[model samples]
Target: MQTAADREAKLQRHRLRMTLLSVANTSLQSVIIGLYAWAGEVGWSVAWRFFLVGAGSSAMFALIIWRGLNLRLKDPGLLLPQIALSVLIQLLFLVLAPKLWVLFLVAVLVTYNFAMMSFSARQFTLAWLLVGAASALALFAARGRFGHFGTSGVSIAILWLFFFLCIRQLTAIGTQFSSLRTQLSEKNKQLSASLERIQELASHDDLTGALNRRSFMQLLADERARAQRAGQPFCIALLDIDHFKTVNDRFGHLIGDAVLKEFCAVAAASIRVTDRFARYGGEEFMLLLAPSTSSDVARVATERVRQALEAHDWDRIAPGLRVTLSAGVSQLAPDESVEQLVRRADEALYAAKDAGRNRTVVA
Candidate 1:
């Protein structure tokens, strides 16, 4: 795991790189204009030429900054046109700056970023090939006018190709690193989710699809803490299969499993969406109703859920063993913990068991 300091260091490095790129891009314009004047082929005022170079670069970099700041490559068809425009601006620099053919060389060198970034490797390679051939031909043409093959023109073209090739390699390496980082993050997320699911399965009953006793209490504790913090209320319902063991002994455990599943389904269907149901243990279950409620409201819901489960047909599952439920209901006491509320409900449940066992009891 990366510490906060490590992450901050990496972020600082990235910001520094972007800062360097933005500054270099803007500064190259003035450098090219200066080179042109140094070569003594211009009929233009030096100050005005420098001003235009600065102004043009400022506008173009501002535009690129606005577009590129929050962009991601995975977003399809997003920054392609912006990069193309950058290339165009660089080409325009080459065309306008007449004296400093070296500057034209630099402009071409710097702005061909699109070849590596916006296009595929094959496309970039092909474009570089064409430009290399074109540069050679242009050099051959300029041989009679300039200082022949020994002129700075030949060296300028070679350096331009070299710079572009270097930038391409750098871009490819960055792209690979970025791809690996994203894959690792996605893989970590998947691993985290899988572990959570495994923990849930271990702590929950398979038949009823509810939290077993341990997870139920843990969840109750969580809810209790939230309610205490907010100074609110929470309600719970404890339900049991009315004659689960009898059903198992008579119709077999498989049939009893079906009854347990059907009972949970019916109870789940009966409760509001805010209710959380969990298998407390064996044939017992618990529900955590959020946003609190009165004792009367809890009792009404519990009775309604019990009646719904009893009313549901078990014949399709067991054919002969009838399945029903007895539930004990409770509301959060003032400043009570999960243990206190559950104990009260558990007490009520056994009370229901003591008082002839096939009904709802309230705590």
Candidate 2:
């Protein structure tokens, strides 16, 4: 699970990267402005002013987001403010360097395009209206100074350079979107895997990988309902590892847990796939065998499990380790409740223990 702090930190890192990209964009524009100034098309002071204002605004936003100061805002990205400021700056430059109005106009469009990545449709519409109104006002105020495009070769070359930069910015945006898509896919897969693990933990024993008692009972009830409707027969067996406490005391709980796990594996392999196996409690297990009509069939199934465990190579686990199981098998009586059936099996299990530790008894 992602903690609040982790989510916040991730957001901060994303915002910081966006800020850096904004700064890089501003730097590119500043370079173009510097080039124009060097060619004597604009004053050096104008280039310096634009560079300082653009870079400083980006740095200010970065600091605010990084310091956790934007959390109170509904739109933590401050998309509107950034777009409004960028448009206003472009208009200012359009008025100051009217001969390069095309350059500044393109820059304003670039700003809107960048905003498209973060803005919702409604937000984008609102940003469009805001920029439209602000541009109208700024253009009106500088009506005489705003519309100049030279027919010189140098001007055409600069226009081509500006188009090339715009293409680069668009490509970068496409790459960012591609990266986000891949990340979303990976996160979705991780979420699915986490949900599967949660379901497994809820339904199965952590150590033996068999159904837990509660889940087993639920399945048993459902099975009983279906069986009663279809007039089918089924049997249940309660199994206990003989001398489990002694094994734990001599070899330690870890070894005891391993033995339990191995026993379940052997029992599962010995039983039919249609049967359901569960860990009833500590060192005790149960099996629900389906389509079984006779006590002889139930006893044979239980005996198979007992024989498999007894024949297992316990020497690989420990030099002197030996393991055995005793089981109690019970068939469903006519109209019998689940509780009664389980109780009868419990009694038979105790009887098996009382008689000899490594055998099966039927009820």
Candidate 3:
């Protein structure tokens, strides 16, 4: 959910803060040394030397900051964790005082800034720990060369300051990560819901909620695949309501819509679970059969659909009204396209219409 601009803003803020913090901490050390030498302990030359050392360390630290900035441009998400750890390491080396207590400070810096942040980001935890441990070893070597007064006293003091900074940074990261994750979750939920709504709208008739003509054709394809896989047998029938136009003529469009819905309900309920039902078009419906033989399934299904609609008591809207349907049934043939199957069934339906007003035809 973070746009390029948002990420760039985050990077720029970290860059500026880290750069300034590094410079400030290093320069403060230089100032202490310079003031001592300038008070005539070691002379002007020594003071200038210490100032140069501090300035040069600040510049090197700044250069590494630039390296991380480049890595961000290349891979912000994949590389920032390591980049942040690198920057923290540079800060510790350049800033912390030479004392035994600084060992504690370095450990705090490693765990809080490097280890904690990397783990929270779900990045490299082990690598960070190893890097921190290496730094600790380096501090131990320095202590051996210089000598500790009692304990790692200087490292301890520096660690307190570093830990405080890390706590603040980690808190901010936690807030941002939580917000981003919440937004992502909400967006995914809405997307899934939208797809379900669209699927319902696209695959079913808007007026009757019956499978529409196009969707019916698609379902046939799925059926063919399934049938082919399982070696299953099935049949399909196309039916059109008789005297549908007469109902519209007598009662108008509103009443005609009610009749269509009523007919769909009957057709749906009359079919087997394995059967497919659809509105082929206005005044017409199709029934896709499953493992039923020849004209028998077609006869039973058509009869039930017709009788249910006729007996449903729609007389108050149009008294003593009677309704019937002509249906055409077809069975699946080996390696047949959906078009071929539907066409054969349609021919049969027309045959039934030609034979009589009410009957089931099979092909």
Candidate 4:
């Protein structure tokens, strides 16, 4: 068995792997943008400082997060530093290459999504504040670099507002979808439980909580087929409560019900867990021993049930009330039908009743 600590460790490792994957993907954007500028593919001068600093800082932070998570640290403050690093990196890129301002949005969106998945509300709020402040300051710094200061500032502000609104709506939708999924999952579990209970009630006896006669007969047929195919023998025992009518007449129907329940309890307790016990009909029961059980084992089990019922303290149920069981045991013959096996067991039960009241007779 795994300890709670071991399970928790496994969960932590999985979470760490997922976090690392997201971080790596996000950082790759910075590397690609930095490479584009370094190659002089864009209009901006190839400021090697900006490219090196942005890519280097993001790589360093990714390493820190990976190492910290591997060390199993649960510190919330870890992301605070990363958020500050993101803002600083964005400010560097914006001030150096004002034309690449769209990259700022990409950086913020990536971090925003990651925060929604991994960080608490407080941490996410801190990230948003850092992002917003960096954007405003970068716009002020790039006043003459991109276009007219007024037009650029207004344009940046409008774009930021739209982005914020869209992100808020997306977060709300994600939350709503998560709640619906949870509700659907719970309903599915409840429906499955109800179905299982209905199946059990349909197949089990209400009186003794055993397999009903029809289900037991079906199971007997399947077992007979399996025994014949495998060339293995099985045993069946037919058990009856001795003088049950007299008991019911003397003790009333309620006490008779109690006696039947108690007899089932005794017989059930005496049999192996692999054995099948079912109420055959009124005042009668059947037991199907496993294919591995021999006739001698079935006989011994039947005798054990008889002795248990005879020795049980029956007075607690009703004053001076006693009950006993007589059973007939039969082993399956090669290629014998289920009906033939049951008939032999039934005949042996009559022989037991005729010979005496409380003994097991084997056929």
Candidate 5:
């Protein structure tokens, strides 16, 4: 649902926040060093050297932030340059710390920042391993300056172990959340499909596979409304199978059912796909045609159904078996009610049956 503009705006806001954080962190470090220099706690030369390093690092980050401002033009996160810059920043911190043992804290901070990025677990693990190894090598190189391996050495090793455990725990939790999300998505899809199938069953007749009377009437109402608005003509036809009761009496209801289904299938093929067909009741049905007038177009559609039914191989149901339909087509008059139209069509159907069987009458 999110538009491209919305996503771009979100990325811009995130990049802005990252830029501000970088500025704030850099400024705080510079201020702290400046305070030490001003108070003479550290010599002005040493303080200035640290201040220069922080300022230079801040400038480098600012350059990256400048690139980030154009994030929409390119990727905004976890570029190789960004990763290298983060590593260089942590190395700067390691070099500036008074005690070599403090490298463990620097490693923890760097790992946390990397974990917050878009890296996969594999990438994070590989990067973290490299960082931890570098920290250990740096400590080993500085061991002579600090004399023997003491409590500080033990504390550094313990912190590294704790960091490793944290990473494993976080990875496990991430995997579980991913699995739960997939299951939830599949359940939502299945529920949606089930609801659709239920609706289809509710809307259609089981025997004829046509719209049920209720759904058909609803569709007719909609078509009527549309025709009224568009000043277009629409019509309905009521059809009945001739002597359907006799077929049931002579051949049993099973053969009668087969004849009804076959008649519907033939009529469906004869009508336009845009037309609506429905089983109105036993041996009765309705047809709705839109953008068409009653006498000519509607009559043609009914005639097609009548001809199709008469031509079909009804003898398959039983020897010498034959079936026919009587239909009445009525066009909508201006501002006519649905009941009035149906009643008129029903009257016409009765007239068709009275005059003769197997025929269509238009009203």
Candidate 6:
């Protein structure tokens, strides 16, 4: 089972990877900015300042996530804060280097595009509005100095190509994330099915599909407690297949297993829906009936199961094969404990076996 600590650790690891990816994105943007600075489109001092601030901010976020500090926040990914800071830095650089304003504008778009991968629709819309308002204010303040595509045609084309390539890369990353989410969803479904199968195996018999001995005992204990508390009476029946060893010795264990399965099916159909039935051990089964007024009711229910098995066609399985059951029924008494009640039922079962092979004895 996955505990809270394990889930938290997994989240931290994922967040760390995201932080590293953000840092790499910042480095890539810085590279482009450095290229512009080298070509004299933007001042070297302004380019270097932008690089320092952007990279420093990314590193700081990475450190916070790595140290498990972001767990304190509602959004542990720190996505909104990162987006806000990145946009503000780009806008600041836009003001500082208006000659390269177009590049910074593209950078702002790229940042929001990346945010789309993690942000909810509402968050994305809010971020978009805030960025739009901030961009308008910055443009108004630097309206007279805002640069256009006045550089050489080659330079303009190259910048345009670089921006397009960046957008394409972000699109690819989004696609990859979408695919991974789908795969994770499928894996979770398979995991749920596997867990359910494991639980069934733990509680039920593998061959007969009846409750295993351990699970049956647990149910018996619970029922006993409930019956005692409510001042009610329930009954237990210990049943054994008559001449089971002879059949197994004559026909082998495979046919013996088939007989066991078919007997359980008939017994289950004969009993009330609320009754519990289980395989106690080899060729021995136990039944816990719902609350009854007398041991006669319990005996009648057990007899129905015996008659059902006796009436079933055994020739289909093996020629001239026959099966019968002997059961012992014991009703809970006012002062009887679970172990004592089961012991009485067991003794009655032995009595029935001694008197005749195919019969039920009440105690």
The lDDT of each candidate is: 0.66, 0.86, 0.66, 0.74, 0.71, 0.86
As a whole number from 0 to 100, the lDDT of residue 41 in candidate 3 is: 27
Clash count list over all predictions: 1, 0, 13, 0, 0, 0
Clashes of 4: 0
- Residue-wise lDDT of candidate 4 within 126-155, one digit each (tens)? 777867787788889888877321235444
Error of 5 at 177 (Å): 2.2
What's the ranking of the predictions by TM-score, best on top? 2, 6, 4, 3, 5, 1
**Of the candidates shown, which would achieve the greatest TM-score relative to the real structure?**
2
Per-residue accuracy of model 1 over 1-363 as CA lDDT, tens digit each: 999978756654553354345445545545434444454444346424544654454455444445554334453232344344544444444444433455445545554553443477786777677566655654454454442122577446544644565465457547846876898999999999999989978887867777787877888888888888888777898888887788888988887787778787888899888778888778888888787666777788788887787677777775765767777888898777678888898889888989987798888
lDDT (Cα) of model 4: 0.74
For model 5, give the 10-residue run with minimal summed lDDT: 98-107
Per-residue lDDT over 1-363 for candidate 6, one digit per residue giving the tens place of the 0 to 100 score: 999999889879977887787787777777777777666666678757877899889989999999889999898989888888989998888887787787778878877776766788898788889999999877777778977544786567658766866776587578758877998999999999999999999999999999999999999888888888998899999999999999999988999999999999999999988889999999999999976546888888899999999999998888889999999999998878889999999999999999987999999
The local lDDT score (0 to 100) that residue 261 gets in candidate 3 is 86
Stretches of candidate 6 exceeding 4 Å from the true structure: 1-98, 101-170
Flag regions of model 2 displaced more than 4 Å: 1-17, 33-49, 59-80, 95-102, 116-128, 136-153, 291-296, 333-335
* lDDT (Cα, 0-100) at 155 in candidate 5: 47
Name the runs in model 1 displaced over 4 angstroms: 1-153, 195-199, 222-234, 332-340
How much lDDT does candidate 1 score?
0.66
lDDT of 5 by residue, 145-225 (tens): 442123454444544554554455456447746866897899899999999889988998888788899999898888888
List clashing residue pairs in candidate 5: none
List of clashing residue pairs for candidate 4: none
- Decide which is better by TM-score, 1 or 4: 4
lDDT of 3 at 287: 86
Q: What's the C-alpha lDDT at position 231 in model 6?
A: 89
- Candidate 5 vs candidate 6: the lDDT winner is 6
What 10-residue stretch in candidate 1 is worst by lDDT? 75-84
